[model samples]
Target: MNSPQTINGLMRHLRNDCKIQISGSYQKQQLTSYGYYHGYKGYRFAGNSYRQIPYSDFSEVVAVIEYDNNLKAALYPELMFIETALKNIVCNESVKGLKLGTFEHLYKERMSDNTTNTKLQSKRLKLRNSVYAKLAARYHDEEEKENQMVRHFYNRGEDAPIWVVFEILYLSDLAGFFECLNEAVRENILKQMNMFDISIDANKNLLSIMIYTLKALRNSVAHNNIIFDTRFKDRKISPVLKKWVEKETGIQNITLYSLIDYIIIVCCLLKRVDFSGTRALTLLNKYKEENQRLQNSVASEIYDHIIQNNVPAKVVGLEAYLNV
Candidate 1:
């Protein structure tokens, strides 16, 4: 008889591991078959299921170990990716009349690609001076009324073409994601306010800065690049700006497992031009629910695990922007 190291010795190994005691009288009695817990017995391969057969029929025996580890290795990582991408889509598409209002556009373009998107890219001043003029005309007394107009104009809806909505959301600020996030950062980081109190330029340079930052984050995820441990190579922001980059870009540093969360923040901020600083968590929840079936079937448990560990709070601190 071959030793245990031989592939054919697996049956002998299994027999030794069994708790059932076999008497000497039963050992020589023709052994037919054996079964184990959890469908290990009668496992079929190549038209073979454990059945009573003569020893001559046992040409070869191979053992395969199957067990459930339940580690869910990619749960958080995949969730992070999905969350970030969806965030960008929802936020960017919420803006009204943005030229490149499609998730595909946001996914494809980089900061360098910003220069090529002429009509796709425009300063908020230009938008306010033109289509969103009512936003600029309002004062403290009628703040609520003016905010309603902005929401009506920019809210993402199925009525409009998907691309148009995406452009609006991506190009818009992320202030709508969280009210506290709004209060934490500079109001004019993107320089939406007009400079020199003259013609509507609205800090064209600042809008350009925002454009490039979003482009970098968008491209990184679209290309399956690493997010948590990333050092963006082609970033255009200065060292001082890097500290507040997430704030300026409207990225709430929560559990940045995916790029979608950041994108949603940007979309909500852009809607702020006309919105009353409403949060997008409700919408985010809806999106997650819609995809729950697939998530569950794929055995992805990151979202649930995150809630259990409360690890997301430690990953990104939106409150830090308040200090910056």
Candidate 2:
């Protein structure tokens, strides 16, 4: 193990070991506030520690850190809105087919994939058990941590409504429920959302897949993980999904490897789900301004790596798409 070092020691390490020009009380204050481990260690590398980013100054690193913080601030509330909207949609559809919206009823009538293939059926059964296990553990005892709403349902010895049930699940767990839901319910959920890809009679499962895919970014933003490099992106962007985005927005290559790509995804979803008629544009403009702010704060090369040149064009394409 290595010896523990003070913030100043970390600063010296940055200057000597990392070959970055970091000095002065202002930079020292930044290192102290953001931390040598979390902020600098995170920003110094591109995707991994081995591949160091071409940062010549501590200010550039600070710029990236600040940009990431701002990006998370900008994206998180919209993410929450989208997640809640999805939950409501799923709940509505799950209940529509049943007189009683009990979890069991939803499980049988709506949640199961109803496949005949043995392997798929086995996987479904295991997943069903997992969901039951998770819910059972959460609702097990009358602890103070449990909410009144949950306690009310539990006290009655009645299963919680599918809506309440979904409210408690993590986004990924919610994705599981969505993935297993009957095709019609999934299609209807997407239809109700007015989702661009799913409602068009194509990519019905895209909604769930999107929930699963975007969950990584959601988790990162929620937890204050690094966003400037987009290393938090967990899954490969599907070509089908990319093509849908590209075809719809007229953006040529939807790599989803840049921060702007996520903005595009959010904008696409927002355009459909946002009722105010101005929220998506507001977000887009905010993103453009933020990117420009980053550009002004850092070297052009650093800004290019962070924001990508295609971002401006993509933003234009997205705005045009939203206007349509």
Candidate 3:
């Protein structure tokens, strides 16, 4: 017979302790706590006054581990990469494609040379107007100010390409992730696809598969969707992937992760593109200060828990991909 048990104060300790070693060997210790307000029938593991259902409900605990790792693992890397890329993109003067003279009027002589006020202001206005107009049209009863602005701009309008929009939102972060890896890994990826094969059809097919893979991962992260264990959001087949696998691995229907893995391999083969290693840590610190400076209750709580626990940081650096 199994006795019912409940866990109340376990979360605090689990978070503060970086690692837990049990027995003679050590494994990554992750604490998953579930609270049932009214305890129900079950068996539970008791430690340090905290109770955990022993997971006897399943044949194994692998499923639970997979679920946790996938969502958190995939998301953190994707998020961290994207954040770093955006920062780099914004800070990198070359990418902005602007001349130093353009910013001279905005700040004092020394400061003015590096300013981005004009472009940033334009971007801010465009975003604000676009958002305000859409909302006003949908909810406001009276004639909206947006109508006047639209008439002023005339009939022509250009919407930025969806892909470009996604990139702009998180450019520096993505760049940082892509930049950090070694070149050998990337060449291995290209080699894996047999891009140098004698047949033109084979080369084309490999290229197509590579493009599709990057695009899919791009879409998932750009849209703020869950990454680890993501159901391929777009199932459009890549003939290149199908053909190459059929010829080489004798398989079809490769996964989205497989494709991104290929891109990562390619990135690694290029000359090393390490960011100032401090960027990630810097961002986390900035986030903490901003939350405190603003006195944002929720942000402060998240900052304390996430930074103190390092859950998000660990997830971003998924150890599995370390050597790759």
- Give candidate 3's whole-model lDDT: 0.33
For model 2, the run of ten residues with the poorest summed lDDT: 194-203
lDDT of 3 at 226: 36
Which structure among the candidates has the greatest TM-score? 2
197, model 1: CA deviation in Å?
A: 18
Backbone clashes (count) for model 2:
0
Q: Better model by lDDT, 1 or 3?
A: 3
lDDT of 2 by residue, 1-324 (tens): 989998889888989988889999999998999998898877877665676677889988888888788889888989998888778777777788487878887777775565776755675576678767767676664466746656678779887777668767789877877777777787777767765464443647777777887898899999999976778888888766777777778888887678778788888788777778787888788887788888888888777656666778888888888889
Give the Å shift of residue 173 in candidate 2: 1.6
Residue 149 of model 3: what lDDT?
Answer: 33
Per-candidate local distance difference test: 0.32, 0.78, 0.33
Please give the range of 10 consecutive residues that has the lowest summed lDDT in model 1: 62-71
Query: Comparing candidate 2 with candidate 3, which one achieves the higher lDDT?
Result: 2
Q: Estimate each model's TM-score.
A: 0.26, 0.91, 0.28
User: Measured by TM-score, how close is model 3 to the native structure?
Assistant: 0.28
Give the winner by TM-score: 1 or 3. Answer: 3
